[model samples]
Target chain A: MVLIYIDHSEKEIKKSSHEAISYGAAIAKQLGCSAEALLLGTVNDDLTTLGKLGASKVHQLNNESLNNFDAKVHASLIATTASNLNAEVIVFAHNINGKAIAPSVAVKLDAGIVTGACSLPSLQNGFEVTKTVFSGKAFASIKIETPKKVIAINQNSFGIQNYDSSATIEEMNLPIPTASVKVTNVNKIIGEIPLTEANLVVSGGRGLKGPENWGILLDLAKALGAATACSRPVSDSDWRPHHEHVGQTGIQIAPNLYIAIGISGAIQHLAGVNRSKTIVVINKDPEAPFFKAADYGVVGDAFEVVPAFTAAILKMKHNE
Target chain B: MNILVCISKTPDTTAKIAFTEGNTKFDENGVQWIINPYDEWYSLVRAIEIKEKDPTTNIHLITVGGPEAEPIIRKALALGGDEAIRVNSNSNDSYVIAQQIAAIAKQGAYDLIMTGKETIDYNSACIGSMLSAILDLPYVSLANHLEVNGNTATIQREIEGGEETNEVILPMIISCQKGMAEQRIPNMRGIMAARTKPLKVVDPVATNAHTSIKEFSLPPAKTGVKLIAPDQMEELVKLLKEEAKVI
Candidate 1:
């Protein structure tokens, strides 16, 4: 059986987990096996909804203590589950939590693992998986030689399908590892859209000049319901918070649509965001390197183009 | 208190990437090396903060690289680490590096272990998480901010579509990113003190490497920029309409 780790926050299921379940189900179909889901910790959301995404069964721990991620504890829990269910392949969404736990589980199971996987494994001759190498610069096809395999699918790499099927939600009773780590306090950064999960992202650079002008970038982001990002300079200058920085020196993100305004595409910055499905460059300078990487380019002042773009999107949404 | 920060010596951010000998190895003829920027921003800065909060606390910088990496190691020492360790190995495999680190971290009795979210060169981002499991410690990645009091650590992680605040106790592992703290340049006194700091050289312990890098190569360069006359805005629109089809 193919088992997927379903990650959740609060009671709402993460969107990327839906894609992971869909991808895992497809992989299971290709392997001539059934797809099941294993969710760790407590979930406030309805677990049964995962069935609509192709999971035949959902194995939920339903333990509140498991909600907070402790990698060793999770690795132990998942390793135990994999053994109990006789799972052949384990899958996770290559989000932050997945990144923390998957490789450790792979080591615990002695399974050959691949992270940042961008597609379904090519199962023609053997199980060959294609993953992004060199920080989204290249692709490599690797064949796992181990008996059990682990793969972490990059978010937005596979499309989520809402198939009309119901999955049986079963509570799995397993020994929960004692939490060695103590919970202190949860300091939440409440408002920003998670970049990895955002379908649309509007980012800026030094072209915005300073923090006061960040309102336009935020305006465009709000207009499209997109996450906000910046080049290293903007963050370095404190025009935007460092968490908003996306580049070789900052966060690496792969969204469906990335709109870069007034930013020159430095190779460092490109290394972090080149995986976006569509890139839109709005810069006044026609020669900015970002225009070369962009699918669409608007050679106009960002100060003018962004507000106009915001208006245009609002108008289009209103038309709907 | 003792803290261990694993740092990687990577190519300077702007160095042009090339390969040598049938693309099997990175061409090191002209590449400049530096303290991997993420490590500087996250590991070193946080280490300095911890040292400042307690003068008796000692921060140790560790890396698995050759003698050529000493300058960058010195740079890290100058960044406020109380001491340094250079493991005598150039193994690039994530598992091998993690094993080397886990060995030292186990013996050092470090109260905390920290690193950057990922190294720019390999971009594996796996060693710390993997090492956390090997050592049986709590691990947090992409920590934008971290606050430690006693044995507990509270961190805010930037997840895919949202932010998650987790509180894990130390002897934990943390991989930090931008929001952790600002990168600090070494002052003159710190630079002078780094020369007098103790740096120990140790041979690597046995390790099991599962993956081997067969070759290295740069990505193909993009075609030169395509330009349309400003008056030809409609032409640009036409290309987007028919060719790019991004509209």
Candidate 2:
């Protein structure tokens, strides 16, 4: 059987988890086996709905302590679960939590792992999987040769597929270890679409001049109902918060539409957003390298272009 | 307190990426190599800051790479580590690299182990958790802020849409990123002192790499951009809606 680890945030299932389930179900189908889900902690979403994304069974481990992420503890529990279920393959969404625990789980299970995997394994050639390497500058096909294999699917790489079925929920009973790490505080960004889960993102850069000029960008983002992000320099200079930064060293996002304004796309910057389905670059400089990578380009000052773009969007919405 | 800082050498961020050997190996010619930015800027600097507060703290550097990684290791030592260890291997396999670090870390009996959130090149972000698992230590990842008091360490890590503070006992592993510490340049005095720092080159223990690279390829190049006139805002909007269908 193939086991997929369901990741959730604040009692809500993450969008990336659906992609992972679909990918795992496809793999299970290829191997002529069943795909099951392992969800840790309590969530408000109906577990049966997971079957539409392709899991045949949803195993829920309900423990209050499990609500908080402890990589060491979670890894041990996952390893034990995989062993008890005779799972030949395990899958996870390669997000923050998955990246933290998948490797540890792989170590415990003595399984070969390929994180940030972009495609399903090619079983015809000894379980080979393709993944992005060198910060998305290139791709490397990795062959995982182990009895038990663990694969973490890259976010937004695999599209979710719906199956016409419902999964039966199974309450799992296991010895939960005491968490060695104690949670003290949580500061969440309220009332904003997270960059990771946002379908559209409007990002600014140093060319915007200063934090005082950010209202235009925010206005455009609001017009489109998109998330807002900044380049590394913008965040470093404190024009934007570090959490809003997206680049090689910061958060990586793969939104459906990514609009880059006043940003001369550096290779490091491109590395983070290159996975976006559609890229639009707006810069006053006609020779900006970002234009080469973008699907659409507009050479104009962001100060004028952004407001105009926002007005156009608002007008379109009003007409619709 | 003893702290082990893990670092790796990577091509300068601005270097053009190209593969040689039938697209199976990274081209090294004309490429400038430096300490990975995350490792040098965050992980090592934060350790140095901790040592500054407590002069009795010992910081050791470790890397699993070939002799070519020496210059980078020296740079890390110049930043603040007292000693260094290079496991004699150039394995790209995370499992093999983690195993080597685990071996050295066990013998050193360090109280805390630190690594960059992820190397800029591979961006696997797995070494810290893997090392902690092998050592049976609590693991905190993507920690942007860290404060230590006695045996307990308070760490702040970013989640999906929020940040969480966690308190963990000593003998734990952490992966650091931005907000952990500011970047520090090595002074001439530190550079001269780093030459004499003890750098022990140890042979790697026999460990099997479960994964091997099959091939390498670049992302598909984008088709030529459709440039829109600045004044034709409606045209651009129409293209986004009717052509690209994104809005």
Candidate 3:
């Protein structure tokens, strides 16, 4: 059976988890097995809604302790669950949680595993999985030669297919190990959408001159209802928070639409956003490296172009 | 305190990716190798932080690769590790790599195991998790902040939509990511110290798994941009509604 780990935070389904379900469902279809889900923590949404994403069953641990993630405890708990359910294949979104838990799950099960899988497995002969290599620069087909397998599917790599199937929500009586660490305090930046979940991202760079002018990018992001990002230099220089940085040295993202303003794409910078589906670059230099990577390019002053772009979007919304 | 950090050698970001004859293998010609960026930022840095926090701590670094990877392992040693171990194999599968590391880790009895959230080369952040399972240790991935106090560790991990804070006992595995630690540059002293560090090369243990790389390919080039005049807001809106279809 295909088991998918549903990653959520404080009651909201992660967009990436939906993609993982789609991927898990496809694998289940290919393997002629049922697709089941394992959720950690408390999510307020109706668990049955996962049926639309292709889960045949949803195994919920649902304890308050599970709400705060403890990787070691989580790995042990999941390993126990997987073994109990006799799971043949386990799936996770190649996002943060997947990266943490999937490998541990593989080791616990003594199973062969692949992470950042971009495509479905080719199961005609054996279980061959296709995954992105070289920082989204290429692809390689890997065959997992083990009785059981683990896969972490990348976000936006597989499209979620809507299916009309009902999934049963079952409560599992798994033991929750005591947490060894205590959270002293949490400093969360409110109001800003996490970059991974944002469909549209407005990013800036050194060309913004300083943090004072970051408002232009923020304005554009607000106008487009998007998240804001920055190149490594901007983050390193403290023009933006480190979490807002997207580059080889920062968070690699694959959003649907990424708008880069005033940033010249360095090789390191491109490594992060290269997987974005549609990239829009706004710069004064027509020959900037970012233009080569952008799906859309505008050669003009970001100071002038960004506001106009935001105004244009607002104006169009008003007209509508 | 004892720490283990996993590393992988990956192609440089600028390499033109291609497949070999009949798409059977990755075309490695003309490709330059570097330490996987994520591993460098997350795993390596976190290990260094532990070492720096406690002067008596021993940081051991390991990689599952062939003889050609010795220089990279040495470089990692230069970066701050006290010793190095290289499993003599070329296994690209995460499971195999985890098995190799787990074997070494079990023998060394390290208190903490760390790896990158995902290697930038394959972007597969699965090794740490797999190793945790193999070793029967708790595993946490994408830990941006980690602090060890006595026998426990407080880790802040990035979740799908937000962050989740947790505390776990040590002797567990952690996959590091952004904000774990600042990147470190190898100074002259570090470079010299790395050359003198002990690097043990061991043959990979035999395994029944016969995982193989069947083929390789490149993603299709992105389509050209649909340019809209600066003043054509209606046309742009129409395109977003119809052609682009992202509205």
Better of 1 and 3 by DockQ: 3
lDDT of each: 0.80, 0.92, 0.80
Instruction: Indicate the residue-level lDDT of A180 in model 3.
Output: 45
**Model 1 residue B17 distance off true place after TM-score fit, in angstroms:** 3.1
lDDT of 1 by residue, A1-320 (tens): 99999887665678888999999999999999999999887777777778889899999898888876666788788888997898989999988788888888877777767788888987785676777766776655566666788889988889898779889989988888787555455545577677767778889988877788888888878877888998988877878776788888777888877888889999899988988877878788888989878777778877777776777666655765
Instruction: Rank by lDDT, highest first.
Output: 2, 3, 1
RMSD per candidate (Å) reads 3.2, 1.0, 2.5
Measured over the true interface residues after superposition, the C-alpha RMSD of each candidate is 3.5, 1.1, 2.5
Per-residue alpha-carbon lDDT of candidate 1 for residues B1-247, written as tens digits (9 for 90 to 100): 7899988998877776666688667667788898887789877798789789878787988999888888988999988888889999987666678888888898887878999988877676788888877888888888888877887777877655445677776788888887788878899998999899998899999876655454454445555445544344445545543565434
TM-score of chain B of each: 0.94, 0.98, 0.95
Per-candidate TM equals 0.89, 0.99, 0.92
Provide the interface RMSD of candidate 1 in angstroms, 1 decimal place: 3.5
Task: Report the Cα lDDT for residue B190, model 2.
Answer: 91
Worst 10 residues of 2 chain A by lDDT: A63-72
Q: What TM-scores does chain A show, candidate by candidate in order?
A: 0.97, 0.98, 0.96
**How does residue B134 of candidate 1 score in lDDT?**
84
